[model samples]
Target: MRILVTGVTGRLGQLVARRLLESGHELIGIDRRPWDDAPAGIEMHSVDLRKRAAEDVFRKSHPQVVVHMATVTHLIERSEERYRINLGGTRVVFENARACGAEHVIFVGRHTYYGAAADSPLYHKEEEPPMAMTAFPELADLVAADLYACTALWRYPELCTTVLRMVYTLGPTGQGTLATFIRGPHVPTVLGFDPLFHFMHEEDVAAAICLSIERRIRGVYNVSGPQPVPLSVLIRATGRTQVPLPELLFRAALGRFGLPRLPPGALTHIKFPIVVDSAAFRAATGFQHQIDEAGAMGEYRDAFPAL
Candidate 1:
């Protein structure tokens, strides 16, 4: 299948594009600018999605599936930029995909839709309603925009549309919380025991995406790995001693120095246990996480020596 990957310049996008290629798919990778070094045997297109003419690029490629990974993914800082890039960019993709007559579009969403509470039941199905918006106003907006992006497909059921609500993915860039601790100025930890959290390796995330495109499954599905790992276990896995600090105290101390507070839903995230259920996705494609929590931690440590 000929696949078009937007945001091919990003870490996740690049990995997904690479995985698809490894699986013998033709790819047309589009980014705002050229990659530092283009991948072998793949076509690259430099087209700014913000520009109206960019739609023609997709139209010309005429891919069978579009793995829409491009977005302003960061939840903290750059609110205006995130809104413009994610909200605007996603809308543009949906409109362009439909116009180009692409057969399938898969959106990569986050698990924030589950809210911050740690005990919150892991979301496995779209039938499991999103938590009512409460705290995390900024995140609420981001999540809302993501949901809005998904809704565009509702208008075009004839098109195979899917939304993959992915959880914290751990990999090379070391952006996720687990990665942060492994290569941290200091490992940040919450007091009164840690909460359960879910993660998937970057490779698996890319694979699941490739599989979804290959199978052309439609509708929303929560994508995550096996059992959620506890925070303490994560710390041990990293071979780092976490400095136990009360959440309120830590935030207050950081606030005193005028450091930006964690994003709206973040505190709720560490306090609550979240396990995204991907059984439906597994059933559809027989996908399983290649790296579990401990294995993922080991990978991060090896990639960036644990202090």
Candidate 2:
């Protein structure tokens, strides 16, 4: 299948593109940032998603499958730029994909939609409803974009759409609140909270995505590592000292001193478990995480020796 991948410059994007290419799929990559060196034969287009030039990629690639990967996290301030890059980008991608008559459009989302309710389901199914938006304001744009992906299903019934939701993924180049949590030398946690977390390795995420596309699976699917680990276990495995603080005090200190911070909307996750059930995805695509609990901790330690 001829495929188009947006945000190919990102670590996850790069891996997904490489995986698809390895399977002999013709690939076209689009990213606003310039890539100095991309693998041979995969066409690269440098242009912002909200720009007119971005549409040319769809026209050029004539993609049968479009892997939409561009998303703005809390790293970008909560401003118009973030909204445009995320929400606008999704709107633009969907519009262009339909215009180009693309058959399948797969959106990569997160399992955080379930939120961090203390009593939330330990194993979340793909069909589980999202929270009522009590917290996670930093994720508003992301949630909006994710919901927008669903519109493609009914509005453009001819188009095939799938949402691949993964839990926190860790790898050498991965970044995000969860990634930053493990990056710090002193891992902080709520005094009495030890939430269960499922962190998939970068390679596993890429493989799951490739399988979804190869199998032409539709609907939403959650992906994660083999098992969920307690936040305490992860902290101990990383050899990082646990700095337990009152939840309120910790946020205040982080804000006042500009200390190492969790990615926006991550405070809730630290206090409550937020994990997804990956059985549906595995059954549908024959996908299973290649890394186990011990291997996951080892990979993380090897990547961040100082932590």
Candidate 3:
């Protein structure tokens, strides 16, 4: 299969493209920017979907499978710029994919789209309406990006769209709150609220993406890891001390310093737990990975020894 992958420079994108390439598929990768030591043999397209049309890449690759992995994880300083890159870019990717006659489009999204609240369901299904956008206005673009990919089916029924709603993904390249907290020396938590948490490994996520492409499965599916872990257990496993504090007091202190490390609007997730029911995807793909929380922390430690 000829596969065209967007955001090839991203860690997840690079890993997914590598797997597809190793499986003997023709690969074409694209990114707005380049990173050091790109994979060899795969053609890299230096195009920004937000700034210009991707028809050139779409026409040139002429892919049967289109993996849309490109995304803006961090909140860019400029509001309009962020919207263009995240939401606008997504619309363009699908537009070009359909234009090029691609058969399938694979999208990566977050489990948080279900919303994390006091009364939120412990395990979320794909049927739930997205509430995270309401909770976190900063995620509006991210949700919009997901909607753009899913709605492509209604707009173009011939295109098969796979929406993988991922939960707290952590990897050397992952920038999620879970990954960052694990890498830090100390973790701050709401005193008595140790919510259940689940994080997916980069390898596992890549494998699931590959499986979906191989099967050309359509519809939305939740992607997650084996078992759920508590916030306290996760911090202890990472060899980090938990600094329990009242939610209000902690927020006040964090505000003084602007929560320097975390991106704006992501602090809410640190307080709530959003777990997913990935059984549907697992049963269908039969996808499994060996990495667990212990391995995830080890990877972070190796990346930053001082932590």
Candidate 4:
């Protein structure tokens, strides 16, 4: 099969492209900017999807499966920019896939689209309703528009589309709250309690995308690790000493810095457990994580020896 991946430079997309190549598929990788560092032999298109004719570029490649991993990420705070690129880029990708007669479309979605509350549920099935966007105003702005674009693709049954609502995908290349916590000056464990978090290894996420492409499964599926680990356990695995920050002191310091105090919603998230039910995806495919939590941490540690 010939596969084309957008966001080929992102951590997840790059890994997926590598796995697809290993599985004997030819790849056409596209990103807004060229990656001189991308693995050799990947046929790359350096055009910006927002400004250029994305459909024409894709038509020339004529890939069988279109794995759409590109998005305006969370750290990009400008909502208007996110709306233009994340939401707009997805619409363009899906429409282009249909026009180009691609067999399938696989999307990487966020679990936060479910809700950030830790006690919300152990796992969210694909059939469950998305967290009320009105209430989660902040996250809603980033994910809701993209979710709509996802639903639009499903209306065409001829296009086999799968939305992989993924958890905090982490490995060495990951950055964000989890990465900050992992590469902390000292490991900080929850003093009172910890929320349940599930992580997908970069390689496993890549493998899941390949599995979906090969199997041609359509529908939303949860992509996550088999085991759900507590934040305390993750801190210990990093071989760093834990400094228990009292909730009061933590809030006070954040306040002094003029940072928003951890809202009850965010705090509850770290104290309770939330798991991703990956059984459906696992049952459909034989692949599982090549690295567990400890192994993943070891890999991250090795990648940055100073840490």
Candidate 5:
């Protein structure tokens, strides 16, 4: 199959691109960032997803499968730019997919859209509406992007649209929200709160995406791996010292003492857990994680030693 992948320069995107290439699929990549070392045989295009040049890639390649993983996930960027890239980029991807006559369109999303709260269910189902807009306003654009991709299912009945709300990924790159939070010597935690953290190895995440494409699964599904563990256990496994602080102090201490700067809304995530049920995805694609929780944490720790 001919596959066109957006954000092919990102860590997860690279993994998925390589996986597809090994499986004998012709790949076309689009990303604003330059992939100087991109493996041979991939037709690379450097362009923002929202721009007109991105549509030209679709018209020329005419890929049968489209994997959208180009949304911004970090908070460092200005909110306006983030919204334009995340939401606007996604809208354009779906529009192009439909216009170019793509068969399958998969939107890779995060499970954190469910929002962590004291009242949140232990395991979130795909049918539940996203609550991050209120609990974590920083993620509003991501939620909107996911919702927009989901709408394509009904809006364009001919397209096979799959919205995958995947769990946090831990791997050698140390490039995800969990990695950033635990980067410093001391990992911060809200006092009296030990929320469960759901995560999987980066390789497993790539395999899940490949499975979704191969099976042509449609609709929304939560993609996860292994069992969930407490936040404290994760910190310990990564060789970081856990620092418990009062909610008030936790907010104040961010961006100080070698910690990464985070928005005020992120505290809710540190205090509560957002776990999702992946039975739907498993049933659809028979996807199982290749690396266990301990292996994933060990690989990350080995890659980035404790400071």
Candidate 6:
């Protein structure tokens, strides 16, 4: 099968691209950043998804499978630019896919769209309406992007669309939300709160994406790996010192001592869990995580030892 993957330069994107290539599929990548060392035989196009050039790639390649994972997931970028890339870029990807007559489109999304709150269910289902925009305003664009991709399901019934809401990822790159939070010498936690953190090994995440494509699964699903573990256990597994700080102190201490400068609303996330049920995804794809929580944490620790 001919597959076109957006955000092919991203960590997760690279993993999925390589896996698909290994499976003997024709691979083409689109990303604003150049993959200078992209493996042989995988065609790569350095182009922004929101530009007409991106559409040209879709028209010329005429790929049968489209994997859209080009949205910004970090908070470091300007809000307006982030919104444009996350939401606007998503709109363009779907439009181009449909216009180009693609068979299946997969949108890789974050499970954080469920949001963290005292009232949230222990395990969120795919049908639950998104609440991340309400709890963390910074994530509004991401939620919108996910919802927009979901609309493709009914709006364009002829196109097989799969929306995957993936949990946090931990891997050797040490580049995701979970990695950054625990990368510093001292990992902070809200006082009297030990929320369960749900995450997956990067390899398993890539495998899940590949399985979805190979099986041509459709509809929205929550993708997770292993079981949920307390924040303290996760910190200990990563070989980092856990520092329990009051909510006020935690909020004030952002951007200091190697800590990430998160928005104020992110505090609620640390205090409450946002776990999801992946039974639907597993049933659909027969997906099982190859790496357990301990193994995933150990890989990160081996890649970047405690400071």
Expressed as tens digits, the lDDT of each residue in 184-208 for candidate 6 is 8788888999999999999999999
lDDT of 3: 0.77
Q: For model 3, where is the 10-residue window of minimal lDDT? A: 255-264
Clashing pairs in 6: none
Measured by lDDT, the strongest candidate is 5
Q: What lDDT score is found at residue 41 in candidate 2?
A: 63
Cα-based TM-score, every candidate: 0.90, 0.94, 0.92, 0.86, 0.99, 0.98
Q: List the residue pairs that clash in candidate 2.
A: none
- Between candidates 3 and 4, the TM-score winner: 3
Which pairs of residues collide in candidate 3? Answer: none
Task: Give lDDT for model 4.
Answer: 0.69
Candidate 2 total steric clashes = 0
Clashes of each: 5, 0, 0, 2, 0, 0
**Local distance difference test, each candidate:** 0.73, 0.81, 0.77, 0.69, 0.93, 0.92
Evaluated against the true structure, the overall lDDT of model 6 is: 0.92
Model 4 steric clash pairs: 195-270, 196-273
Residues 158-225 of candidate 4: C-alpha lDDT, one tens digit per residue:
88888887767567785534554456446544477776677766777777778888778777778787
**Which stretches of model 6 miss by more than 4 angstroms?**
none
lDDT of 1 at 267: 62
lDDT tens digits, residue span 60-176, model 1? 888888888776655555467777777788888888888888889988887767666544564445666566256565665557656876786678776789888887788666765
Off by over 4 Å in 2: 255-259
Tens-place lDDT per residue, model 2, 1-307, is 8999999988888899889888999999999887778899689999998888989879877899999999876542467788788888998998999999899999988777677886787788877777725676777777788888877778888888998888887766636556676676777788898888888788888898898898998888888866888998887886666778898887766633334655556688878888788888888888878887767677777778752
Q: Cα miss at 186, model 3 (Å)?
A: 1.6
How far does residue 81 in candidate 3 sit from its true spot (Å)? 1.3
User: Model 2 — TM-score against the truth?
Assistant: 0.94
